[model samples]
Target: MTGMRILAVAGGYPGWRAQALRALAAGWPPDAVTWTESDALPASAAGQMTLDYAPAPPAQTCAVAEPAAPVPAAPVRISRDFAALLQHAALYRSTQRWALLYRALWRWQNGDRSVASAADHDGARLHAMAKAVRRARHDMIAYVRFQQRAGGGMPEYLAWYEPGHDVLASAAEHFARRMGKSSWWIGTPHGSALWDGQAMHLSGLPADPAAMPATADQVEPLWLAYYQSIFNPARLNEAALVQHMPVRFWKGLPEGPLIPAMIAQARAGARRVGQAAAVGEMPGKPVPMEAGRAQPPRALPSTLDQCRRCELWRHATQAVPGCGPQGARIMLVGEQPGDQEDLAGQPFIGPAGQVLDDALRRAELARETVYLTNAVKHFKWVARGKRRMHKTPGQREVEACAAWLEEEIARVKPRVIVALGATALRAVLRRAAALQDHLDAPVLRGDALVMATYHPSYALRVQGVRTPAQVAAHIAETLARARQLAEATLPA
Candidate 1:
């Protein structure tokens, strides 16, 4: 302590690393030296420097070199991961940080591996600081909102932030990668970071973060509208929101003002249990869930395309409504429409449709003479490479389309209703029965004699049990049976 040197660093990772390495190489133990941040940096750690707010202790030196190199100590080694962790923890704004790091490094270098394990006291402290710094970096990246501004020697975009840790320099690189050649400035109370498209410039401490001049984003209104539209009141969790996004940051966010009002509205009585306020104001009827309670049914054909009865309508091209002359004595109901039928906005017009057309012709029944439709009007498909391969409609989707199927039977007054597949069987009978159990058998539903068989698409499936010829024959036989039943069951 009689003639000790206070090593000065210009500040930041590079500055600290240089001094730490020199201190290690000089064989000067951690207790033999002091560290300080300096604006007047000397030639090296061995030369004199004037302290310039290092956030550590004040320097007590008068043009003195740290300590004479007493044969360089054996080069110390640390894991690459621990080295990186040291770099992050170095940014923590604590006066004891420099001493803490040196103690850990000295212990680890001297065969005490416990110094690098979080279970140890020094290791736990080191790891905690690093974790905190990492979180601060992430928060800066997540919350910094850049607004584009008119150009006049100003960057293309500008933002203001106040991160808890000194992470502006490290976090600015994230915006550069995402913004893609866009120049920007992020001003903070402790520091400011700027990217000039090609490279970044970082400076310590800005005059005032409030003095950060910029215009509001031109697209902010649109963004606010989108944000509001998706803000589900029913799912609002105020505590979690505040925990994740601290109130200190709210002042800088564009949507900050709206969040409180929206949350307030959400907590108000009945409004707390429903959709976004903007969406609840939308003009749409509640889809009829119960026949007894619902308003009189709308004309089903005219309204099927607007059906929000199921989410299936979203992917479908359009509702493939039942086609052919109304009042037909036979209604041939298949499963959902096939690919071509979905695109053409007409039923029974795809490969399966081709099979149906030939089957109807061979059954001695004209296509125009019978009502043709599907139990589920929307084509449910999942993308397979470039094509939309058929996916069976879930039970929920099948039940959702049941009302439309029921209305179709009533309108057509079909004495015979052919349930072309299992979906058709479920929709028409309002029950779950395997197609195999009901195939070639007719069950009575109200005035209609409902029959079930293999859908025409069953034949189109590769290496199917039923050949293309066999499928067409089965469909033709079902149609023939339906026609025979319609003629035999004469009206009273």
Candidate 2:
């Protein structure tokens, strides 16, 4: 082997090429062999060995093959994990992938079993390549929207996808298993897969996107509506969304084009929620203004269960209404109910509520003297595994619940209203304004002297600015000020 002996195999089948690689590696020194996908080899290289390859044997049979031990006592030791990793890495589009896999296999044969460890340079590179291949496969499975073709017998389904790696064949079994009874075809730029309810056939011929039917399925509208409904404006993280579903796959996704408009509408809807609450039209019902015609303040608790102003009620256990005397002189409003509050059907009983109670005791303010409530009555959350993660209520949700908050204010008529956080501040102000702008001083909104302060939750989250002792001290100072203002403004 004066020079590298080039070996080329037909592309698109990782198992077929892997078989050729193993046969060559077993006989020749890894350094003397240069492997390349046949499609990539130059036309002038006619002298290079083009191996007649076939798919490798089943995993059990191919697990380990010890030939009459090589002249150099080191026998090629291959594990199932190593073989699988190499196969996946071979699907990568890199020109140097063949050489890299050969080198790693050579190391494994030379008694270095830890070549697959992330600590090794070749191992790290292989891991990254394998990760990319896995992600491409997952994306293919997730974003492939099958459009039901118009037919009579055994309804055929067609889907168009563009995978970043050579994953069409690797991912075919998944679609086959998932759509067992249905006949489907998944076409990609590199190849296509056809499943006929029983067996799957793969082809290397590239698919033309224009050749696919452009007609939308009947259920597309329903899917788009559902997609729009679940998109939380408050929890929008575009970067994370794009990371999981790359923009490259957007062309094939039915919901992709709607993202920009949906995001814009969410922002606009948030603004409208704030503005609607600012005026007296929130909850979209006209306020009856006949004297003595108002519903009894005490009846609000029972009526809250019937409230369906927003979608939050759909998931929450029950509405957690305001908990305090009807004529309390001080009102404390928080953002919304947390997990514990939602479950107990009570406000200010969770960890944040405990912090509030402690702060009230420190400030010489009794919890009984203040009306405790949240701007949004129902709990908004998204399920993560077994736990329900809290999601911030969008402005529309706040606006929808504004009628309840307004009624509470009318019933209590507190001299001083303490907005606990940004949500509470927005509810009271009826417009979007930063909490920091009003933190240092009191602002008068209508008949109430509105004061903004850090919610107990925020105080709990404060790592800097002071110790836990200092957090309590700060809360005490704010409450002390609230008390003085309430007293001075009472019927003066």
Per-prediction TM-score to the true structure, in the order listed: 0.52, 0.51
- Which residue pairs does candidate 2 place in steric collision? 278-430
Error of 1 at 385 (Å): 16
* lDDT accuracy of residue 369 in candidate 1: 93
lDDT tens string, model 1, 341-401? 7766678877888888888888899998989888788889999999998998888988878
Off by over 4 Å in 1: 3-5, 39-72, 151-153, 210-212, 270-272, 275-492
Worst 10 residues of 2 by lDDT: 56-65
> Which residue segments of model 2 deviate by more than 4 Å?
11-27, 47-75, 152-155, 212-214, 266-492
Query: Relative to the unseen true structure, what is the C-alpha lDDT of residue 247 in candidate 2, on a scale of 0 to 100?
Result: 81
TM-score of model 1 relative to the true fold? 0.52
- For model 2, what is the error of residue 53's alpha carbon versus the real structure, in angstroms, after optimal superposition? 7.9
Angstrom error at residue 202, model 2: 0.8
